[model samples]
Target chain A: MLTKRIIPCLDIKNGRTVKGVNFVDLRDAGDPVELAAIYAAEGADELVFLDITATVEKRKTLIELVKRVAAEINIPFTVGGGISSIADVSALLNAGADKISINSSAVMRPELVSELAGEFGSQCVVVAIDSRFVEGEHIVHVSGGRIATERRTLLWAKEVEERGAGEILLTSMDHDGTKAGFANELTAKVSGSVSIPVIASGGAGNQEHFLDSFTIGLADAALAASIFHFKEVSIPDLKNYLKGYNIPVRIEK
Target chain B: MSVVIVDYNAGNVQSVTYALERLGVSPVLSADPEVIRSADRVIFPGVGEASTAMRFLKERKLDEVIKDLKQPVFGVCLGLQLMCAHSEENNTDCLGIFDVQVKKFEPTLKVPQMGWNNLEHTTGPLFKGIEADSYVYYVHSYYAETSEYTIATTDYVNTFSAALNKDNFYALQAHPEKSGKVGERILQNFLDIK
Candidate 1:
């Protein structure tokens, strides 16, 4: 059976982990490679490294960091943030990234999604959509959800899938840091509308939130940042908890 | 032992190379016929479209080289699909190393079944120390049907060949490089194949 995925997303700035990760075993918490290895050992289904780095010159740092992580970590990881062009994606994949996720770039030039899916195959192209429930409808937001776009959340999701994106990473801006719950209504609607797998992101405070995301949200995967980083929920315990609910999760032996 | 990962336009060969490095073997990513032919073990790893990959392999004449390899040759993901006789992906004909056909997954589930799934009914040297229900990472829309060559199987939309073994050629529908410790053991088993 295809197990529902449990992903731990790490924010990267200047090649170092932006949020302070509280791992007792980690000597250097800022090292993304070590944190990634630790997560893989603890049974993370996959890892996502969102490069929050600002400058283009320092982007090389992320590439080097990707290489180190790929060499050390055994599981698949996706590299995102500030990736707009084919060259940027080429460099990251060459540096050993299994997949690459695009956001604002795809919204700016939607053809980049098709181009990437054509060049690298859709299996490696993940389109991340940040949306927020505004007024009466869910609106698409870009530039790390700071700016709103003209596109509706559901239409954009369909468009990216039509453009050959293999997966969709849907993050609810309204629920991101709230710790209340996932945007289950939006997630369920998008997941139902698209044939590609949908990964529900944001608003995970406890193990029950993840369960809600998979069950109510209809997400194929659930991604959380602060919870996994702060050790609020160990992956094994989370998987075990999910298993008790009959959610098919991969438990590492 | 010399290990070579057949290189063409396939995506993400670096991960497979790194996995071998973790197993203490420096693998050469080469499209050269002589280099691949001379290697003690040849890993045919691939990611991307079937027809495009087939085009690149034919242009470089690696297809014939791969078809004739006598050493223990392992194929991963798209590599496994391309080894089959035909692929429903792009309606392309593959190097007929394995007697199976690749078909697209039905839309009842996600097109590209991406995530970890455990291997069942696994038997053969490649699964030596690996436990039953050991999960491996997979990301592909097409899968090769289970056949006489299937050594292991996994259930997704339906039962499909998780791993296939026929003579010196072995293939896995999953990415062993990205499958963590269970994947490490599978790669190590391939290395230990004398």
Candidate 2:
């Protein structure tokens, strides 16, 4: 049985973790490597390091960070944010990142999805779609969700899958940071529509919200940032809760 | 112990090398026939399309070297698929180290079947201290069917070979490097094989 995955997403900037992590034992909360190791030990099925660093040497810093994290953390991690070319993805994968997520680049040139899948295989490509429900229709947003695009969320999701994306990371701008719950209705529609695995991101406030993402949203995996970083919900406890619900989460032995 | 990961333009070799490092063993990545053949343990790691990987392996003559290795040669993911007799992917012929056929999963569920899945009927040195419910990470569209070489099985779209062992060769369909503590222990056990 393939168990539902629980992922901890960390925002990386300048080769360091951007968001303030609240892990007590962490020596340097800014150190993404140490933070990644902690999360891996605590039963994080996977990790996503979204690099928000923008500079001339951004690629160098990200590759170095990826090498360090890969050497320390045993679980698979995905590196995303500003990854626009095959050269960038090649360097990161060579540095030992298991998967790479692409956003605006895919929207700007959708051919990139097919090219990446053809060159590196679809298993390594993850297409992240930031979406918001606008005027009774879900619209795709780019540039960290600050700008809206005419591409419909569901249409883009299907297109990426057809273009050979291995997975879809769908984040809802409406529910993010609300701590209310996930956009289950929208997530469900995408998950049901796409054949590839869908990872529901954003709006994860509580353990139940995580459960809802799986049960109601039909997400294969659920990703959260602040909840796991702030110790609001422990992974083991959440897995246990999901297991009690017969959700088939991975149990540590 | 000289552990060398056979790199034939396949992905995930770095992760496998780092996984060995975590167990206090530093592994060298090499496509050189001498380095791979002379190593005490040769780790064959791969992640990519079958035919493309096969082409590269043949180009470097690593396929012949791998097929002739007497030392413990462990294959991961696509490496495992390439060890078989034939792959439905690209209709390519493999090294025939393991007498099995690699077939694509029916779209009853997800095509790639990505996520963590537990191993069952694990019965080899690679699974020495691994518990029954130990979950390992996997990402692939195709799987090798269970055969006499199968040492372990996992269920997703169907029951497939999670791990395979035949004489000096051992292989795993899942990414042990990314499977956390249980996976680390499995890698350690493979290194401990004598």
**Per-residue alpha-carbon lDDT of model 2 for B87-134, expressed as tens digits?**
999899999999899999999998898999999999978999888968
Query: Where's the lowest-lDDT run of ten residues in candidate 2 chain B?
Result: B5-14
- Candidate 2 matches the true fold with a TM-score of 0.98
- How accurate locally is residue B135 in candidate 2, as Cα lDDT from 0 to 100? 95
Query: Which residue pairs does candidate 1 place in steric collision?
Result: none
The DockQ figures for the candidates are 0.92, 0.89
Where model 1 places Cα greater than 4 Å from the true spot, the runs are: none
lDDT by residue (A204-224, candidate 1, tens digit) is: 999999999999999999999
Q: Per-residue lDDT for A29-60 in model 2, tens only?
A: 89999988888888999999999988857658
